[model samples]
Target: MERRKFLKDVLKAGVGVTAGLTVGSALSFASQGKIELPLPYVKLDPKKVADRAYDGYYEHECAYGVFNAVIGELQRKVGGPYLGIPTLMFWYGGGGAAGWGTLCGTLNAAGAIFNLTCKQKDFKAMIDTLYEWYQTTPLPTYIPCKGNWCKQPFPKGVSHSPLCHVSVQRWCKNASVYFGRPILYNSKERSERCARLSATVAAKVVEMLNDYHFGNFKPHKVKGSQKTKMDCRLCHEVTMKELS
Candidate 1:
């Protein structure tokens, strides 16, 4: 009995020591400020990223969901600097910045991902590409499987703008779903729609990141002119980059 107790204690001590060393190493790396400004990129599978974001939304809503989908994957794939990032901080970005309905939380998270991975000179272009694609594309295009939270097919719509207010309102209008108050927003369909949308956005971000890393990144070109609010042309339409 004495010898067995001694062995158990030794095993516990060994585990504690190993855990301490791992944590200590992480702390030391943070203190040294060695995490590079543009964090290293490794190609990621977009499908996997989408699945992660879909699940993440069930836990933390849009911004944190999309952010974790990418960063968490990085932490898993490349352990050094990524493990130090406090991903939970992004939880505040949900509901278009705490339900104020400003920039879409997914876009906010995607912008951050681009900033962290792309070069300084390329950042603006990458953002432009994403915004344009988002504005024009029919979102929530990723349909969840039969057993998933959203089993039925949901309506899709284009925001024509990046604001969450516009995006969600436009989508709700298309779906004929009312979602402003807490009760309305809490509906299963609404939650599922956002979850799938989060997945779609995360997948797009991963695709862009992979293309950028592979040196095949291209700014999406506007094929034809599209109309925005007539009065806001000076601010929105007259820009050199065309929107379609």
Candidate 2:
């Protein structure tokens, strides 16, 4: 009878231990303010941490407008005579409206934020520097067609490629450098992910901007051709070389 009673106590102790662990884990998550949502592309649910970076204006317009505002503020802080209006107009009119898909929108937004904080005059030059830094960092890789941004397959039967999240983090780092304050996220890991996405989008915008600024947009060479003969890739290569 004593042996049987001992066995019962052991089972109860095990159950208590398990219950304690579960409650502890749940409390930890609650303290972090993380809402676990199943994202389609990412293997893990991204923690929805509140950003404590800059307390600047957060607008609900399109990505381009947000980026432009960030860039404008950066230019103004850096002593640009006229608040980077020319650069903003150039990018907004050409890149945002045209929708060139080179850099991701998040990257563009981060770049703009960096520009405002750093007060840097040459946004393009800064972006190039950030890109070089990003090449050295380890990034998350996702199958191209499976993630939130991309759902459709390419023309051929090729599966999705790896999306670089490190680049976005680098952009955020640069922004932090310029802002002179740390933009704290829920955790360092979540901050890194958010930064990476933001930078990716921004990079796409930059690519489009470069194409519009330097590419030779002209009439098609083929007779009765509806499409223009301008080569965006060729133009970008040339512009990148110049920047280098």
Candidate 3:
């Protein structure tokens, strides 16, 4: 146990040093004041982004999976200062903020990337479209591992809400699997489903980024009346318009 603790401490120290170096590099560049927030982004291939995110899910779960996939690809393609980003910090977003199951981690990661690379004026609009897309689309449509990791038949479902628990419970219901506990949540089939979903989200984010990079991106506009079917809208219509 002592040895194990010592090794754990050593690992933590190493991680701290590495994180410090990366952040130091980024800050050094920042001190020059030559760079700005929402860093440079070149066009990235959606297919490659999907592939990386699919594999990344196994290593770091959902949020960091998508975050690292995009940022890591950026570092590979455009190495100037992209290497300085501390991508591992995104791991906290996994399991909907460490298992509380709040917002879907993939969407959270996508939003972060959009803010990181796109203009602030445009990022929220991009997030709006992406959230709506996630809410409506049948997910796990981009399966990278067909018969290999997912030997058993897996199912898909549409998540009407962007909350991770809701999205995952929807899939669990469709797949006829239990939705509680780590053992069931970490089941091979469900895990693979999320991996594919991460890939799908990552690919979509990359495509959107590519479009923005090339001046082809457009934000979706949903009419206020069509936003939801709840009766609260009757009382909140004016409030909604003000917010919008």
lDDT of 3 by residue, 1-244 (tens): 4744564465557556755778978677768876566887877888888999988888888998899999999876665457778888889888898889988899999988998898878888888888888888888788674448555444678887788988888787777643333335667777888899989999999988888788777876443345652234323555755655
Give the least accurate 10-residue stretch of model 2, judged by summed lDDT: 38-47
For each candidate, what is the lDDT?
0.78, 0.35, 0.79
Q: Which runs of model 3 end up more than 4 angstroms from their true locations?
A: 1-35, 145-147, 150-153, 177-184, 221-244
* Candidate 3 residue-wise lDDT at 42: 77
> Candidate 1 has what TM-score?
0.74
Superposed Cα deviation of residue 171, candidate 2 (Å): 16
Q: Please provide, for model 2 over 1-244, each residue's C-alpha lDDT reduced to its tens digit, 9 standing for 90 to 100.
A: 4744564465547556645778888678768976332111101111111111111112221244435433443343332232324444333322223344344333445455444333234444545444433344443222122234245321111112111232333444554554556533333433334333333334433333334334532211121113422233433456656543
For model 1, name the residue pairs that clash. none
RMSD of 3: 10.6
User: Of the candidates numbered 1 and 2, which has the greater lDDT value?
Assistant: 1
Residue 21 lDDT, candidate 1, scale 0-100 = 74
